[model samples]
Target chain A: MTAATARRDFPRAYGKVGSLHRERLWALRLSYTSLIVAAIIFLAPPVYMLMTSLKTNAEMADQTLSPWLVRSPTLEHYGATLENPLFLGFFANSAIVTLLVVSITMVISVLAAFALSRMRFWGSQTLATGVFLTYLVPDTLLFIPLYQIVGGLGLLNSIWGLVLVYPTLTVPFCTWIMIGYFASIPKELDEAALIDGASWPQMLLKIFIPVALPGIIAATIFAFTVSWAAFVYPTAFITRPEEMPLTIGVVSQLVRGDTFAWGQIMAGALLAALPPVVVYVFLMDYYIAGLTAGATKG
Target chain B: MSEVNLRKVVKLFEGGVQAVRGIDLEIADHEFCVLVGPSGCGKSTTLRMIAGLEEVSEGEIWIGGTMVNDIPPKDRDIAMVFQNYALYPHMTVFENMAFGLKLRHFPKDEIKRRVDRAASILSIGELLDRKPKALSGGQRQRVAMGRAIVRDPKVFLFDEPLSNLDAKLRVQMRTEIKKVHQAVKTTTIYVTHDQVEAMTLADRVVVMNHGVIEQVGPPNELYHHPATIFVAGFIGSPAMNFIPARLVNAAGALTIQLGQGLSVPVPADRTARYAPHASKKLLFGIRPEHLTETTRTDKQNLAPITVDLDVIEPMGMETLVHFRIEGTPVCARVDPAAGAQAGAPMRLAAHMDQMHLIDADTGRVL
Candidate 1:
């Protein structure tokens, strides 16, 4: 409640009223303090990376400058990273894997969601719960077992193996997101389509797809970001520098046991984070609408 | 236009709960039939069974002389308007109307012509380019109707189609629906819980209660000649009041004795018809409009009683007076100039000719 309203509720209690105003001031102070602290906590690393990526190597080793600021800014590392064929291959591999995995995940999730939410059959509820439950599995616990399966298929050190294991991380949650969107739609809409002579496939493509477009975009972001930033699966599956995605390639190749190429590493990290940031920025509204629609279905 | 028929249709849900208990009805070609009742009364369920949206646990549903028990809704050649309108939110009004015909593989020119014609018939031609979400509630309602009309199906099914509109819009749309029905000449079955809507829109009204048909007749017939006490009470506004009384022999004639020393002679024509139930407890039925402030007029079948009016509500066209008869609350409609006052004794006349005597034990009217 506002201070003015609180005072109006008890006009004669002078000391208590003072304490109420004090309490509100303390709350506002604490909230802004915590918010600034959180913003620093989340933003410090990215800012440091950008600052370091823009600094010359001489400024980095000089030991007389603030590490957070660049005295002389240059784009040398960005140019050098782009020119390196190995780094370019890493970018290409990450893009290919993300594209394939996202397309595959979307197809599987949208169909699974439609069947589970609309064409409900025996055990469908159990199956839907099972799909969400799979998303709860941590990647650290899943990687070793996936390692053996990748080795058995002879896809070791291949980006193709990463393509196979990525959907395990992406599909279950995408399907869950889509299921919430599908279930939120009113039941009568489908009944209307049925009376309108729409066949099952026709109903899905024309009605559910267009109506639930926001959910689809949200799920696409999930798949895109997950596959693009995946580290554990690619670390376990690929060993060759050329076969590695950007996540594994930057970390493994940019460090030589003791010395680090800080500039190239920061440049690579920023580059790797760009696509997801772009996807998120361009489609932020749909993502929020999708998440809320799923949450408030009932 | 094609006739629709239902024979012994039943809807038995899972867990042994019955929603509809084997009721039958028939609507003539081009007839506007309405199924109306209180909520959970199976009126909508019966309409769904006819539209093939609900399975009829055991009976035949015939549309245009064809049994459709095994047919899916898409193949049933019927269109239904939902209470929520159920217009496809993503589609333009024109596309929503044409989706059905497009699915049936109608040519593009034919689809456009049909959509345009239906749009004009509903006077929603300007709204055809807008999405359903962009239109007002009444406009969305028209788009839904346009979607149904463009198909030109064998039968039209409407499940409380106008329940979402405000009262003024509901009355206006009620007239709009009637006008459209006249223009289309399609056999339609509509469902609503509002009795006023049923009375105004239906060529035939079917009153349902507790999974069974209570009565079926034209609106005026059902109002004037109700066969059961339930129908009598359900058919009128302000409701028909039922006071506990007894059909007794009064000086070798039949008189219904209401307690508090109030009694009225049965009209001569009905005395022989009611004689078999003499000396039995009965319910005296009278509509609020039939009970009014007494004046010097034809007293052929008039009965007078003085009551202490408890509440008087002045509705511009008529004043309603409420009081109790032997602890049974009752209401009467009188001329607004009748000077009804609360807590004042007033004499009101009840027309005995329009009165009904119901058997209390069986709820049957004589």
Candidate 2:
């Protein structure tokens, strides 16, 4: 307790505390820096799209104008894209296809996930693994056979073709996400529900669905985004302008052969990407939680 | 009519894991029966079978005199409270309690009344508006009980519902559950690994081990006259101490030879029962409370022994003196004022009448 010893020990203790604080500060700075760099890298393309979408056709054609900057920003491109009948038709097509596909995917995946996770039938585990493996099959590989199925059914130029094929892509992955989420729920919840006089279907609608809402939202987002942006099937099957989705229609109608209306194209692309971006911005927490819950809990 | 009877019920899970072997139990109406044992002892599995959560692999389960082997849980008229509470996180406390009634298509007013009654019974009326996530552990537990009580099912199944609470909360919840059961008077089957919970809650305790029922009796019956060695060891706190001993007939009196030059005379009633094992090795079982500091004058059936105390745990009211007899560690609960010290020789008296002589080979009480 002497002043001599106190003075000698004080700096050492203070030094230890000071270094700990500095280490934490350095870690915070490093993480923030990396996050900013990552944000810039990822946000670059969207930012460029937004800038280009605001440019006039003449400015876009000018070689001297910086692509990153719209010297005279105009809403004309957005107005043009929105006013185009073909664009409105394609937007309606995407909406119908995305809504139908998401609804079907949710219904099918929730039931499939419930059966795979809780109901102990034979081959349940193998079937669960098989569902995930089916998702791993590339869409490019299935598009050829799918082309025949669409052709055989004489639905080559129909929006229904997209609806049918999109589920094949969306169901497996959505079911896999849902299965992990459902499996993470305590068995006791369902057991208590069962003992409380809830039938299997009642349990799903009342207990499982509400409890696994985040996973359902994540799956719905995946389905909506996937169907909205789908290109390969819509391009291969639906050759008619009226039946083409927003993704394929934008490229096909906006850009004539050897003629790229770059400003309108960028505007349409930005507009098309808006739905998913808005959805993700509003529900980013649920999306990330549902996705990581499967990996961590499993 | 609400009685549940399981006849030779067997549960063999996939991959050949025998969770519950053939278990035959009959729980009478309005009886609070507890199934207790260590984890993986098939106690929970047995309760699940009765609740129709797990299928009976071999035999029939009769609920209210009806063979319900093929009946799903919903049709079986049982309500279960889980260890984790299992309150639906999405629903308000009132909604969670009313969900079962709604599914049954009960009248809206009736459902409201039942939920309100149950919530008031559990003293969670103020919590009716909150979701399960907004409730604390004890509140969630009460909500879970309220969910079950609202149904007013034929049987109540509790799967260690209070195990998640802290010690003081567990004790509080324990009494609350008992009081609820008394008021409701439903045929109940509770499962827990805590012997104290079983001893306190059950009208009858069914002790299970390794997928088999070891014994079924009242708590005092299991304590004072455990039918098996496992029951003796599992049913008491600071469990009963066991010593390897040999019974011998010396001058027409049967005495248990505990160790080198140490013999305690067997009681007259037990002498006849242990006569056949006179020359055989046995396990001498004695609860810590039965052994005390030896006084100047020893009462009848109180055998005196002297041993070097290895450790003395002074527990305010009584001292737990730990020592070894024939290299086997033994504990004796002596008076705190006995002046017992570690590594010092101390005289203690064992109540011979309370001693149990178990067959060492079979682990069965003689």
Candidate 3:
């Protein structure tokens, strides 16, 4: 063999390549291996849920060692889950409440954030910090006190109660996120707009809102997800069956005392998670930017 | 065109930092007035105050006979080009140029026509569809100029607009701006720290230092007849040389005794200006180019000094000879064929006609 061919065949060649390249290759191999292993470990539970959702109850209960595949896949669970009047009602109520709550949160948060971020006013910085601090308060601890307030306002057992309560959890975080996002826009851009005869409202509408659309999208996703998957306040305040959102409705109606309807519960959980996933899929760039704007600006 | 008048304008920041102090200027119609100074000399703050971008702490600003203290930038009938070009990155060049006109509710056709005309004037018509980021730095600068031109405002404000370009492009744009000013003849107030730009582009230059007006005059006038010692030192490239000397009246002739036994008799006409200040110390100032290698044929009031040469830098047309007299370093521009060399003695005739005597104490020109 020629020297090049002989070296290639010997498998001990390319001595000039530094050790850093070999180390980097090893590191990349380990990273990919760990990444796939971690993904499988974390995803196994969800995969099992989906698998069980597709299987009949008989196949699901059959103590088979290999649970990855089913002899008979069925759509009974999807049909039953959709056909159930309570489930359908809860889905509709959840949709309406989540949409309304997210809408209200978006409107209030964006306006308040624009003011806090762009407008120079007394106590604005302090008020903005206070908004973030409010987000730090655990919802589990505040829901009890919020329940009495909601009940005192005669909004108990009503979707309005959940709608009003949902914003309490979402607005602070959303507004805080938006404030940071809006603040990241260069001050010169606004100054230019102002010099161009744009009023404060016009500056925000023409320059800021358009430039910070990504942040607003991320905040919207956050608020929508929070409102959709929220359980504590809704379960506490919304007691009526028809008024129930999906999170509490699935637990109360589908899973009874000692007889758990895992398929429907999993289906409801998957549907409840779908909106945020779809939103993130569509606007992941903005969501990541909104979350990391503080780091970038700093 | 419009005239801008500022009387006793002072700007004090919140932290008691005084940026502009008691600045008084009058820019006539179609005049290209340049406010030139080093950084922190209040030139920009003064321009911003006139543009209504910065609040005037104490002053009256009148544009075209109307006081505009509280009027906003938009109402001032002026357009300003910032140092960074400040073009809207998201907008196309056409849209960027059209923004001001559209804000005034100008007709669509008029806005388009004005933008197109400005684009043609700036030769950016083909680049109109491209965003600011798509254009080169010089192209973006032209787009900014086009935006200002499309406004057709009474005045234009340029805040160190060429500072962002490289040296070669800056020189080219300086000429471009001068030609544009000549074509439009709109009153312009430009601020810059580059003395070369001020000298080349300004109809009249305002030299500022430490929040005060050091001097104001035409470039050549400031170069030749600087009213103050600061202006003399600040105006020229290689700056005017300042040498301490003793002024005395001896034998009915006013003469200055420079160090190293050199004396220059002052002219009879100009000597009368400082005749009373005899026996006082003064600063003898002269430009490097004014010191000639050729001898003085008049043979009166001429000062010849022995220069201990440290280095000789030769250009094609002239040579810069570095030397010292009385421990103060000095440079003299001589013809390249003069055959001056390093570490050698050279004699230069200090032209008394082109010299200035400044007060040693207060630095006021005599």
User: Per-residue CA lDDT of candidate 1, range B1-366, in tens?
Assistant: 489989999999879889999999999999999998889999988998988888889988999999999999988899999999999999999999999999999999999999999989999999888999899999999999999999999899999999899999999999999999999999999999999999999999999989999999999999999888988998889999999988888688888888868988899999889998886778999999989889735667889999999999999999999999999999999888888899999999989999999999888887
Model 2 reaches an interface RMSD of 1.0
Top model number, lDDT: 1
Q: List per-prediction Cα lDDT, in the order shown.
A: 0.91, 0.91, 0.86
Best by TM-score: 1
| CA displacement after TM-score superposition, residue A287 of candidate 1 (Å) | 0.9
Ranking by lDDT: 1, 2, 3
Candidate 3 docking: what grade?
acceptable
Show model 2 residue runs off by greater than 4 Å.
A1-18, B296-299
User: For residues B44-82, what per-residue lDDT tens digits would candidate 2 score against the true structure?
Assistant: 888888888788889999988899889899898889888
Fraction of the true interface contacts (Cα pairs closer than 8 Å across chains) found in each model: 0.92, 0.92, 0.32
DockQ, cand. 3: 0.42
The C-alpha interface RMSD of every prediction is: 0.6, 1.0, 1.7
In model 3, what lDDT does residue A293 have?
78
| Segments in model 3 whose C-alpha atoms lie over 4 Å from true places | A1-20, A64-71, B248-255, B262-268, B278-281, B292-302, B312-318
* Residue lDDT tens for model 3, B1-366: 389999999999989999999999999999999999889999999999988888999989998888999999888888888888877766788988887777779999999999988888778889999998899999999998898898888889999999999999999999899988888888999999989999999999999999999999999999989999989898887888998888877888887877766778888878778788776678989898877676524555456777778999998888999887787788899888787999998888887778999998888888
